[model samples]
Target: MFLEVKNIVKSFHNEAVVRDLNFSLDAHKTLSILGKSGCGKTTMLKIVAGLENADAGTISLGGKNIDNVKPGKRNVVYLYQEDLLFPHLNIFENIAFGLRIKKFPEKEIVEKVNAMVESLELNGQETKMPHQLSGGQRQRVSFGRAIITSPSLLLLDEPFGSLDAGTRQRMQEFFKSLTAKYQITSLFVTHDLKEAILMGDEIAFMQSGRLKVYKDKTDFINDPVTGVQNEIGFWENLIPGKVERETLRK
Candidate 1:
């Protein structure tokens, strides 16, 4: 296994957020954490990313206990719903920030940044500032910055949630291709179940700080008590063939 989150419990002001959770992931596999608003999904991701610690639990990456580790050395990169790129830095500089911080050679940093730009289709946008780019472009930069670090794991918190339907679908395809190409292990958090099915290899459903997994898409759709299936099924079931090609396009 590449990551293990064991019996995690987090609370604030005596209000439980993440209730006793246990899950693990394999190397190079993508996992999505799905739930409604304020289900402690984001908190769980933060715990694994080392940005927040669990009140009672353990997070191990590559067999190392990282509960007390600092966020920078945790070998995980996080991309938030909004573009969290450095506002003052240009695209090239923002993506190269990690390499520069690690003191990589100038030539290597250039090469790495260029490769990432090409991969992310940010070729000519390298010199643009954060305010100059569109929402989609800025999100791309956020993803590029995280990937450039070569982190052992990546966490995306509703990365495409801010984009419109069309742009969001486009990014979904691009991100899916990128992750599959790099074989990156990630724990993605989102409220969109359709996004989870299309972007993640597997998904864990969370309800009020609790997490559960289904055997497959079919099982997920048929869950009686929770109705935890992907939104596509829910939509299709409600309106047969109403799901047109355009509705699900990238």
Candidate 2:
């Protein structure tokens, strides 16, 4: 296991938000967590990233216990729903910020940043500010920035939730391609079941701070409580045709 979260527990006030959460993720794989709002999904991610303290349990990454590691030194990155690009920096500079902070040699930073921009298809827009790009484009920039650091783990919290349907779909496809290209180990939390299926190698449901990880896609799709099958059924009934059914399957 590349990342092991063992018996993690966190509470707010007097109520437990995450209860003995235990999960392991291999390197270069993705795990998607599905849950409704206030299910503590974000809190779990925050704890894993070392942003929030866990009252109990441990976080191990790369076989070492990182429970006491500082957030910056933990080799983890957290990205939120909004693309938090620096408004003052252009696309190139925004992506290069991490490397600059690390004081990488000038030539190396340029090479790496340019390669990442090219991979993300942002070559011609390197000089644009965050406000100049569309929502999807801004998010691509965000993804590039986080991935350029080559962190040990990436925590994404509903990163595509704010986009329109068409843009959201495109971002989902883009994320798939980026993950394939980078082979990043990511823990993604989203309420959208379709996005969960699209983004994760394995799906897990989070409710009331408890996590139930499905063994595979079949288990996820077949589970009644996940409501994935119900959502699919809704689409199937709404559009009655073999083509529509096949489209839904895809």
Candidate 3:
């Protein structure tokens, strides 16, 4: 296991938000966690990123216990739905921010930032500011910025929630390719069931502060609590026999 979270618990105003959470993720794989609003998804990611304190539990990353590590020192990056790029910086500078913070040599920073910009498909737009880019493009820059530093873990909280349907789908595909290219180990939190299924190498569902990690996609789809069946039923009802026909064709 590259990242291990054990017996994690959290509360606010004496109301438990996360209960005895336990999970392990392998390096270079993405685990997509599906949960509705206020299901402790963001809280869990914050805890793992060291942004929030866990009342009890242990977090280990890359074989080292990080329970007491500071957010900056944890070598973990937390990305939110908003592409929180620096408005003052151009695309190139935004992606280069992390490297600059670490004070990498000037030549290396240029090489790395340029390469990242190219990978993000923003080569000629390096001088453009965040406001000048489309939603998907800005999000790509955001991803490039975070990934350039090569963090040990990346926590994504509904990263495409703000995009339009078309842009969101494009971003999903882009994210898959980006993560693979970087060999990123990420915990992707989303309420969107289809997105969850498409993004994860392994899948888990969170509800009422507890989590259930499925053994595989088949198990996840079969679990009634996850609402996959309900979704299937809705479509089946909408166009009678459509699902069965598609399944049979396959």
Best by TM-score: 3
Q: What lDDT does candidate 3 reach at residue 200?
A: 97
Tell me the tens digit of each residue's lDDT in model 1 across 1-250. Answer: 7888899999999999999999989898888877888999888888888888788989899998988899988989888898888998999999999999999999999999999999999889999899999888888888888888888999999999999999999999888888887788998888886787677787778899999976665555556534533445567788877753334342
Using all chains and alpha carbons, the TM-scores for the candidates as numbered come to 0.91, 0.95, 0.97
- lDDT winner between 1 and 2, please give it: 2
Q: lDDT of all the models against the reference?
A: 0.85, 0.92, 0.94
lDDT string for model 3 (27-139, tens) is 99999999999999999999999999999999999999999999999999999999999999999899999999999999999999999988998879999989999999999
- Under the 3 Å rule for N, CA and C atoms, how many clashes does model 1 have? 0
Candidate 3: global Cα-lDDT? 0.94
What root-mean-square deviation over C-alphas does model 2 reach? 1.8
Please tell me which model should have the higher lDDT, number 1 or number 3.
3
Best by lDDT: 3
**Candidate 3, residue 198: how far the Cα is off, in Å:** 0.3
How far off is residue 20 in model 3, in Å? 0.5
